[model samples]
Target: MTKVTAQLSVSLDGFYAGPRHDGDGDWMASAESHGFFRVTRWVTEAMSWRERQGFAGGRQDVNSEIVAESFDAAGAYVMGRRMADGGEVPWGDEPPFRAPVFVVTHRPRERLVRQGGTSFTYVTDGVESAVAQARAAAGGKDVAVAGGGSLVRQVLRAGLLDELELHVVPVVLGTGMRLFDADLGLDEFEGIELTPTRVVPDPQVTHLRYTVHDRTPLTLDDRGAGTEKA
Candidate 1:
């Protein structure tokens, strides 16, 4: 069965991106200056990541293997419009993701066909629709929710995410874009649970994988109290 999975590199303080700026100039500069690169430095230094980006020479350690494994597991991807737009220039003609990518956005645009197997399909409806399309396109492989925080939160809140992989770096950013800044709006009766599946420790980063389990809401009694039925 195809599973919905998400991966992100976060700071020790739980920030994926740096602080938001007011104007485009400030934002662009801040994006570069902030802890964004620091948090993702591990992957950027990996041989697998370097190879995908058509670069030369990187470390072929455990981190590289993990990166390769993630890329191999994902057959299709779903991401937010902001992330897609931001990556367009950096990713160039041959994007790292060599699979069909569904972009969740309000504005409708024609499908973008790139070099290799990468193609961007803009989804105007919602995240759920995007994930559904990605799953269908995955061809029995896992659907990767490549995100910019908000998209990941939306998928998790909607109970569409099946697995989550967090690359926790040691450095702490005092102020930045937190991965869980907003409420997930989980069930009041029975909140969601994450079962730890794997953990890979490294000097620069710690890789943690969890299987998301949405628990059944508890039964309510006559007095509106929560109860578990026998």
Candidate 2:
């Protein structure tokens, strides 16, 4: 079966990117300067990442192997409009994805064909629609949710995410956009369960993979609230 997977690199404090400021100029450049670069340094230094970006040399360690594995597993991708816009110029003519990318947005736009096998198809409806389109395009491989926190949260809340991988870096950003924020609305429910499937410890970062479980509701009685299995 084709699984829906998501991967992200975060700081020790659970922040994926630094806090956004008004008039911060270019969002991408500002994020890099704030702490995005520090959080994702491991990925940037990976040989697989460098090769995908058309760069020559990089470290070919365990981290590089992990990066390569992720690239190989994903056949299609779903991302938010903001992420796509921010990455458009940086990704250049031939983006590393090399597969069909579904962008969830409110605006409607024609399909964008790029160099290599990469192409962008804008989905105007919602995240579910984007994921459905990606699943159809995956060709038996897994669909990756390439995100910017909010999109990932939406997928998680909608119970569409199957697997999640977090790359925990050593550095700590005092203030930034947290992956698991109050906006997630998970606090109201019993919360989703995650079964740790894999753990890879490295010098630069630690990779943790988890299998997401369906949320189980809390059993309420005359006395108090208790837990119950799904």
lDDT of 2: 0.91
lDDT of 2 at 172: 83
For candidate 1, write residues 1-230 as lDDT tens digits: 99999999999999988885545685557853467888999999999999999999999999999999999999999998988988999899999999999999999999999998999999999998999999999999999999888999999989999999999999978888888865787656776778999999999899999999986677766884566565
Candidate 1, position 207, lDDT: 96
For residues 1-230, what per-residue lDDT tens digits would candidate 2 score against the true structure?
89999999999999988886447487556764468788889999999999999999999999999999999999999999988987899999999999999999999999999998899999999999999999999999999999988999999989999999999999989888888877666656477889999999998999999999998776566653454555
The local lDDT score (0 to 100) that residue 212 gets in candidate 1 is 95
For all predicted structures, in order, the TM-scores are 0.90, 0.91
lDDT minimum window of 10 residues, candidate 2: 221-230
Clashing pairs in 2: none
Q: What are the lDDT figures for the candidates, one per model?
A: 0.91, 0.91
Over 4 Å off, model 1? 26-28, 31-33, 187-190, 215-230
